[model samples]
Target: MMTTTSEIDSIKKYKTNELIDLLRKEDLELYTEDLEIIRKQKINGRDFLNKNKEEFRNIGFKLGPALRLKEFAEECKKRKKRFSSYKTKKEVVLTKFGIDNSIKNIPKFVPQTINISDDDDEFQYCIREIKRKMEIIGPARSSNEAVRCLYIETILVSAILIVKRIVREKIFLEPQREIVDEEATG
Candidate 1:
């Protein structure tokens, strides 16, 4: 699939913010007017996910955009379901290999939260360690478990690469906070 936007909020239970974010994806080909109509109609994320093609047409969507939107929503829904089903088991397996969930807030695959900062050299080191551990995954007794481990590691590395590229491009800037002058306050 062509990755036109980050998957930051992909697997979460969707709400108004999530709905608007989904609409903002460039591949959706929706206009601001279309977004206004959705807002005016009070079409929340759940409504967006559940509405079929006919229902979307009834809501005044053009055929092409409607189909694309529906497909996108279904894909997100599938990812959410897949993540939820293995949520606990994934944690246990990661923990067994001394992996902790330090990575958080990444909007990418692996179905787990990942947070990386521009200056996070430690994260790069952590990725290396994860890769090292993955070599041991092949010798595990259960093929199924080994496969899952390898899959997770691959996804994790891919997510990190994406993040690193984003950082390099200056696309993922940290939020700016206003610096208050102590002298002025005093």
Candidate 2:
């Protein structure tokens, strides 16, 4: 899901037209800066992959076929997906300088291993250990750590959605909907 501030959802649910009007009233520079950060992150991820093509082959062993770093980098560059404001022309324009400087500071890779002593509950123990390690070491490192954090966040968000669905079913309540009355004039 696209990242939106909590206030945006409140505004969307209660006062959508007012939110649009507010958007028009605000200076575009704030939006532009937000877009720039997104752009830099994408570019950084792409560049990291490009710089360590061989290392990514090792990472692919653990991460599997879904994320091939080299290919992802190439795709990012080709799509020019770095800049968030590209889709919305009203946002400010900054000179494209390839990847951001902060990306260069991050390490390309970190070593990790999964230790399984016996076949008894091996799968369950491994999963538990992995989760534990993720919590402990996730924020301490850079580059690969950041990517791992993103994956963890994605999994957590998906799990939350699943739990929300289950709870909604258990409660026997209808899902909330926002109704817009286009015909109503004040």
Candidate 3:
């Protein structure tokens, strides 16, 4: 992960020039020691490992966020499995919902149990429910089919409600009609 001035010869001229320009702009020399070029590391501000675990205890953050070392280690193990399973270059993604393979990088550590005290958590809870429902299910079942089934169930419920309302009206009207007939006969 650390790069020294000695590796300068092995690097291409254009790259060296680029680094040279970057360091020059920062008023630093290229031959400086202890220069680190960490590979495969993003310099984003969202460093879950560095974030204090207690911040989550006080704040309203959802999910584990992998704050502790133990949690992060477990997350790493899960990610290694995912990366191994989906090794092809096409499966790698940058964000959660940006691309088709966006979910490929989600480190599926034991899914965090969400505490739903309010109504906001209901949507995520329902999605997790679907996950559990289709968990034992095979890849043969399509998402379109799931949506179709839900729509059909909605229609069936509406029909049942309509039929029940009609039957109730008939029952209430039949009693009134019988009383009128009895009075007319009397």
- The digit string of per-residue lDDT tens for model 2 on 16-116 reads 33433433344323244333333444333223435344554443322332134345435434444344335432222221333334456445677545343
Q: Report clash pairs, candidate 1.
A: 8-107, 103-114, 104-113, 104-114, 104-115
Best by lDDT: 1
Which residue runs does candidate 3 get wrong by more than 4 Å?
1-143, 169-186
Tens-place lDDT digits, model 3, residues 88-169? 4554444333555656555667954534343434344444555654555533356755555544444454444444554575
RMSD for each of the candidates:
20.4, 27.4, 27.1
What is the C-alpha RMSD, rounded to one decimal, of candidate 1? 20.4
Q: Pick the candidate with the highest TM-score.
A: 1
Worst 10 residues of 3 by lDDT: 34-43
Off by over 4 Å in 1: 1-18, 87-186
Q: Which ten residues in a row have the lowest lDDT in candidate 2?
A: 88-97
Candidate 1 local lDDT, residue 83: 56
Residue 150 displacement (Å), model 2: 46
Clash count (model 1, backbone only): 5
List model 1 lDDT by residue over 1-186, tens digit each: 432123424423466666876678645878877777677787876677777778877888888867877787777667656655665766776666666654453335665455667556656665666667567654334556446655566556656566766567544434335535664431
